[model samples]
Structure formats: structure tokens, C-alpha cells
Target: MLDQDTPHAAMPGLEIPESVAAALSGWVQQVAEQTAGPVRAALEQLESEAAELRDTGAELEAARDQALAASSEHQAEIERLTVELRDARKLATEALVSKAKDQLAIDGKDRQLADLRTQLERNVAAQGSESDARLAAEMELVGATTARDNFEAEVRTLRGQLDKSYAERSALRAELETLRGKK
Candidate 1:
């Protein structure tokens, strides 16, 4: 038991005895241990949860980095494919232009062939007209030659008849003169 009139019980100039101070310190330590046990367990559980959360965050960050890398690779591939597609379009356009030019050349050739065919047909027709004209002229020449040869033969026959008549006349005259002299 403590004396109530002790200086330690007074508000000022208080001094505690060594035995009671030690007993009070021991009781305070026991009460602190008893009250802090559940708090410590809870703090440990929170710290462990925080460590797990940090690990999960690191994993998420790594996953995000991998996703970003994959996205960058996909973007580069898309760009490359776009360039290839543009080149392909350019090639296709060039091919189309070349084909159009070739078609134009072929059309020109076809026109030239058509013109040549027309000229050949005209030449053949002109030659046929010339051949017909030449054949007609040759027939006229042959008719004229046949008429000249018939006229020459008729003149020769008339000359031969005239000679025969003259010979007969001369023989008669001689006979008449001889007869008269004899008589």
C-alpha cells in the first residue's frame, strides 16, 4: 500500500519509490505487448499484401512493355506492307499504261494493214481494168489485120482474070488475019 501523503502522490515535487516504479514499468510493458499483438499481425499481413501487389504491378508493367513492342513491330510491318502495296499499284499502273500503248500500236498496225489491203484491192482492180482494155485493143488489132489480108487476096484474083482475057483476045486476032490471006 502507498501512503496518500507521499510526495509521489502530490502533483508537484513528486518522487516515486523504486519498487513501485519498477512494478508500473513492468505492467505497462505487459499491457503494450497484449494490445499490440493483433496490430502487429495485421501490419505484417498488410506488408505481405503490399509486396504481392508490387510484384503484380511489375508483371503488369512487363506485359505492357511486351505489348508495346509487339504493337511497334506490327506498326512497322503495316508500314512495310503499305509500301509494298503502293509499289504494286505503281507496277500495275505501269503495266496498264504499257498495255494501252501496245494496244495503240496494234491499232495503228491494224489500220496500216487495212490501208494496205485496200490499196492492194485497188491495184488488183486497176490491173484487171487494164487487162480488159489491153485485150480489147488486141482484138481490134486482130480484126483489122484479118480485113487487110482479105482485101489483098481479092486484088490478086482480079489481076489474074484480067491477064487471061487479054491473052484470048490476042489469039483471035491472029487467026482472023491468017484466014483472010489464005483466001
Candidate 2:
């Protein structure tokens, strides 16, 4: 019986059967498999070649895994940057809209201020004309009052001259009557 750790053909000083050795030799010659005069030599060469091929396959698998990891990392970074860019654009648009609304409100307030100023100026102008008319009416009233006072003074002086003329005429008539009584 062959142990799991030791092959039967690898034991030193062990003799193989004549029929098994003849059959192995004939198969090696038929297949043209090269060996170091022992059937184990060909098997060792085949195992070395298989090990080298497994090492190459392992190296290729590791490279493929690394490439996939790098690609995934790049994709994650791109997605994060895309989300950040979208947020920035949305904030900028909102800021612009708010600024536009504020500007329009300011423009409306400015127009209202201009209209108020114009209305105040028109009211002042109308008041200026009313004040001028009031002053002219007062000046005419003063002129008429002065003329009436001068007319009253002239009428009083004329009545005093008429009374003095009547007294002079009565004295002259009495002197003539006395002269006639003396004759």
C-alpha cells in the first residue's frame, strides 16, 4: 500500500515488476516523451511546467483585480464630483433669481419715489399762485380805504366856510337901519 505522503515509485531500492516497466517504456517511446532514464523524470518535468503556468495565471488574476478596484474608485470619485457640481449650479441659479427679484423691487420703489417728488412739486407750484392772488387782493383793499378818508376831510372844510358868510351879511343890514333913525 502507498502512503499519502510518499509515492510508491519514489521509494529507493524498490524494484518494479517487469511487465509494468515494459509497458511504461513502450508508452514513453511511442509518445516520444523525454526522460532521465526514469519514468518519474518525465512526470517531474510536466509538474514544473504546470506550476509555472499556475504562477502566470495567478499573476494575471491579481492584475485584473487591481485594475477593477482602480476603475471602481475612479467611478466613485466622478459620481461625487458630479453631485457637487449639480449643487453648486442649483445654488448659483437660485442666487441669480433672488437677485433679479430684488432688483425689480428696487426699480419699482425708485419709480414710486420719482412720482412722489413730481407730485410734491406740482402742489408747491399751485400754492405759489394762490399766495400771489391773496397778496394782490389785500393791496387793493388798502388803496380804497385811503381814498375814502381823504374825501370825508374835504366835505367837513366846505361846511365851515358857508356858516361864516351868513353871519357877515346879517351885521351889514343892522348898521344901515341905525343910520336912517339918526337922520
Candidate 3:
């Protein structure tokens, strides 16, 4: 029991009534007993929630790592495919150029063949003209041959006349010689 007559120990900046202090002490003890069970239960619930949060954080980190790895692999694949596509495009361009060159060569050959055909036609026409000239010359030669045959027959007749005259003159000379001898 506290002595009322003695100086009571006072908290700094607080006045206490005897009856109120006794009632406050009783209230503090009653509240401590009443709240102990619920407080322990609330602390346990908080601890469980914290543990679950830690586990969820670890799982989230693993998921993030897996996603990053998949993304990196996908990027690598995209790069490889891009290179392949570039090579294919290059090959296609070369093939197109080659085909164009081949087509140009074929066109050039066709033009040459056309020119040759034109030259051949001109040559054939020239040959035909030569053949016509030869045929005309042959006809002229045949007419000349007939004229030559007629001229040769006339020359033979003239030679026969000369031979007859020569024989008459020889007979006259012989008669003159016989008369002289008789005289």
C-alpha cells in the first residue's frame, strides 16, 4: 500500500488522482490478458503472408529468367534467318542477270541469222541472173554455128569452079605445043 502522507513519486508532466490511478492499473492488467491470444494469432498470420510473398518473388524471378532466355534465342534465330534471306536474294539477283545476258546473246544470234538470210537471198538472185545470161549465150552460140556451116559450103563450091577453069587452060596449052611440033 502506498503511504498517502509521504511524497508520491510523480511522472514528469503528469498529475495522477488516487482513484484514477487505481482504476488505470486494473484496466491495463485486464487489457493485457484479453489481447494476448488475438495478438499472437495476428502475428502468426503476418509471418505466413511474408513467407508466401518471398516464395512468389522467387518464382517471379525464375519466370523472368526463362522469358529472357527465350527472347535471346528468338533474336538469334531471327538474325540467322535474315542472313539466309539476304544470301538468297543475292543469288536471285545473279541468276536474273545471267538470264538477261543469255537472252541478249540469243537476240544477237537471231539478228545475225536474219542478216545471213538476207545475204543468202541476194546471192541466190545473183546466181539466177548468171544462169539466165549463160542460157542466152548458149542460144547465140547455136545460131552462130548454123551460119558458119552455110559459109563453109559456099567456100567448097567456089573451089570446084577454080579447079574446072585450071583444067581447060591446061588442055589449050597442050594443043598449041602439038601444032608447033607438026609445023
Among the numbered candidates, top lDDT falls to 1
> Residues 13-73, candidate 3, lDDT per residue (tens digit)?
8679989999999999999989998999999999999999788767666655665565565
Which lDDT value does model 1 have at 182? 41
For model 3, give the RMSD to the true fold: 54.4
Off by over 4 Å in 1: 1-31, 123-183
* TM-score of predicted structure 2: 0.39
lDDT of each: 0.62, 0.57, 0.61
How far in Å is the alpha carbon of 112 misplaced in model 1?
1.7
Comparing candidate 1 with candidate 2, which one achieves the higher TM-score? 1
| Tens-place lDDT digits, model 2, residues 88-150 | 556555655655664565456556555655675877655555555445545554554454454
Point out where model 3 deviates above 4 Å: 1-27, 119-183
Worst 10 residues of 1 by lDDT: 174-183
Which prediction has more favorable TM-score, 2 or 3? 3
TM-score, each model? 0.50, 0.39, 0.50
